[model samples]
Target: MSMKLITAIIKPFKLEDVREALAESGITGLTVTEVKGFGRQKGHTELYRGAEYVVDFLPKVKIEVVVAEDAVETSLEAIAKAARTGKIGDGKIFVTSVEQVIRIRTGESGESAV
Candidate 1:
């Protein structure tokens, strides 16, 4: 069976919204990692103890979801909608084909393994 892996980098504040949206869209599981990076916006400056400096890495949430081929677009749409903030650092979504998936405990493969 064909599968797709979706990795979304979103603002940390939007994690809950994205999680709820994914669940409502029939996505049962996913992995999340707290990350930091910069894009076209580069980075930002803030005041720390009355001192101002530029922070190069912005905190973000990385969400990884693997699903059946048929669910790819719907899942992407859901994530985009829920994570959107109309801002420059809203982050990105990446999609690629997954060659295989295995659930060791159940020995299930393909979509079942997902």
Candidate 2:
């Protein structure tokens, strides 16, 4: 079976919603990381100690999930619907082919490993 890696960069506040959505869609495991970056939304200004400063990199959450190819579309829909805020900086979803997967503990490979 073919596999894919779905990476989504989303607003920090929406992490829980995305996780719940993925779970409801039958996605059992995923990895999340705290990240910072800027896109078309560019960044924003913030006040700190009464001083206004430009925040070039906004806080974001990166979610990485590996699933069977057949599950890709459902996973994408789940993520998109859950992550979208109808505004800028809601985030991006990237899909890439996964050549292989291995379960280190059991030495299982391919679809089963996933």
Those runs of model 2 whose alpha carbons end farther than 4 Å from true positions after fitting are none
Which candidate has the top score in lDDT?
2
Q: What is the TM-score of each candidate against the true structure?
A: 0.96, 0.97
Candidate 2 accuracy as lDDT: 0.97
Q: Write candidate 2's Cα lDDT for 1-114 as tens digits.
A: 789999999999999999999999999999999999989989999999999999999999999999998999999999999999999999999999999899999999998987
Local error of candidate 1 at residue 41 (angstroms):
1.5
lDDT by residue for model 1 (71-98), tens: 9999999999999999899999999999
How many clashes does the backbone of model 1 have? 0
Candidate 1 lDDT score at position 33: 100
The TM-score, computed over Cα atoms with residue i paired to residue i, of candidate 2 is: 0.97
Clashing pairs in 2: none
Task: Kindly report which residue stretches of model 1 are placed more than 4 angstroms away from their true locations once superposed.
Answer: none
